[model samples]
Target: MAAEIRLSPCLNDNFGYLVHDASTGATAAIDAPDAAPIRDTLQREGWTLTDILLTHHHGDHVGGVAALKEAYGCRVVAPHDRTAALPLVDLRVAQGDVVKVGSLLARVLETPGHTLDHVVYVFDDDKVVFTGDTLFSLGCGRLFEGSYPMMWDSLLKLRALPDDMLMYCGHEYTAANVKFALTIEPTNPALLARAAEVTELRSAGQPTIPVRLGVEKSANVFLRADDPAVAAGVRLKGADPIAVFTELRERKNKF
Candidate 1:
């Protein structure tokens, strides 16, 4: 049986996901944006919530954790927050830790950027990555707790993943992200095409997540800090990839 993933909307712009292992009937919620919506979805899908996997300490991501845990007794696995910022974190994992949802295994990556302790979950065999807010579709997360260099390193690590893997982020910011991406690479045909498609999906109330990593490499400026074309577009020719990334992130702050 294949892994069944359910992308759910929570809060105003946040997204939550529910992944169920078909072989073991074990289910996991990736960032509990809110409890009611996740509960509703679980009930609708007839899947039991056995685990709550968190990516950061943001309220929009963990807001529903307590409710869901109380209702389902699910184990909460979050970043290494010794202060116990989370309502309940059964385990605190860092880079290279392996978490399990039934027989399915997910490797934890310490992708600190948006937050100092932020992380991403990778189910290698499943070819899926729950990126949280570290890497979005066409843009990366805002630098709130970490520096440009920190975020850049985190993103580059994710860039090493298999090109064919599916990427699931933590927000419904695809259209806006792609819009901002155009400023850096307006002539990029792939970027332009993706922006148009995103416009159509958002207009029709459709999601543009679970995007292919390969597609993102071509379209997401943050992911392509090392690409010569992107560097040239930003007038930073011959500069280090990290320099280009810093400039791009600064521009996004104002965008």
Candidate 2:
């Protein structure tokens, strides 16, 4: 059976995802930046919310869990740390746990960089991943709690995934991310083409999310830290991948 996904904008720039398993009608909201959109999306589609899957403990991500649970009686799944501030978690998953979203199964990858409790969901059969603030199109999340090494390791986990995976991140920062990426590897034609496409998409008032991982694998600066061209751009020509990644991330933070 195929899985269905719905993308909606929440808060000012954050994104909310609604995924459903067609065979079982098991619907889930990946993260609840705001309740109104998630609530309305489920209502508008007439799909019962069965689960609220959290990627981190950030308020923007978990803020709507309580209201949605009260409205739909959905079970909540989240990482097993810093969850005291979140609503009661029905399942506290660690790395390598398989979560059933209806008939679909999602494997959890603990990716702590933006936040200490960050995790991304990979539904292998569906060729989709829900990356809540871990990785974005042409960029990665800002380091707020974890260190450069931790974030670097987390990114490698994402990099090793199949190239066909479609990434659905937590925010609408593609245009900005692409801009900063150009400063890192301005000579990359793939990045240039992608940036142009993103510019056009945003100009048309379209959402530039659920980006292709294949494209990101080549264009995202954070994901290409080992590339000689990228290392050269940062003036770290023969540096280690971790060091290059560290420099790239710091440059982006200041970019």
Candidate 3:
């Protein structure tokens, strides 16, 4: 059976996810931003927390790891990067390694851009990907420890995934991301439609995540750095894709 997922809001815009395998009654929290919210959700759902998957060492992402671990004694699986100061990891994983949460398996993909130790979990059998702070709905995370090229390559790795996959990111920044996207590709119908959808979702106090990766492949300006139209929109028509990507990132930083 596919893993059932629960989305919980944590610390303003951060998101905490619970991945449950029904067959074995095993549940894993994607990243614990806050223990109170995650604990409350677990109690409400009546699910025992067996695992805590750490994407990176960011405070907003792993702030509640210690508390959750202490409460539930759940195994903490973190990236193998020793430089990242993560908390109480029971298992350290890296690229190509598969972490099992009961019967469900999550393939680890190291996407070091937002942070050097960042990794996203891809559950191929369930067609779901937990993109912590790597690939957002319409925007990518800012380059804090990695270079532009490094981030771009990391994004491409995600872009290569099957279009049918559903993406669950770490934060709810789609509204602002769509606004900045419009400045680059105002005439794009996909972007326009997505903007409208986002506006309505936000107004209704809904989360704009678990979005189709196919939709992002077309509508996300950051993912279209190689497209001629996007290059032209940024006034670097014939520039290299890296150059275009760099320009776009710089502009979005200011936006």
- Please list the C-alpha lDDT of all candidates, in the order they appear: 0.91, 0.90, 0.94
Each candidate structure's TM-score, on Cα atoms with residue i matched to residue i, is 0.97, 0.97, 0.99
Clashing pairs in 2: none
Flag clash pairs in model 3.
none
**Per-residue lDDT of 97-185 in model 2, one digit per residue for the tens?**
99998889999999998988899999999999998998999989999999988998999999999898999999999998988888878
Scored by lDDT, the top model is: 3
Residue-wise lDDT of candidate 1 within 78-182, one digit each (tens)?
A: 999575377788899999999999999999999988999899999998999999999999989998898888999999889999999999999988988877888
* Candidate 3 residue-pair clash tally: 0
Better of 1 and 2 by lDDT: 1
Span of ten consecutive residues with least summed lDDT in model 1: 81-90
Quote the positional error of residue 74 for candidate 1 in Å: 0.6
Say which prediction, candidate 2 or candidate 3, comes out ahead on TM-score. 3
Q: Where does model 3 exceed 4 Å of error?
A: none
- Candidate 2's C-alpha runs over 4 A off are 82-84
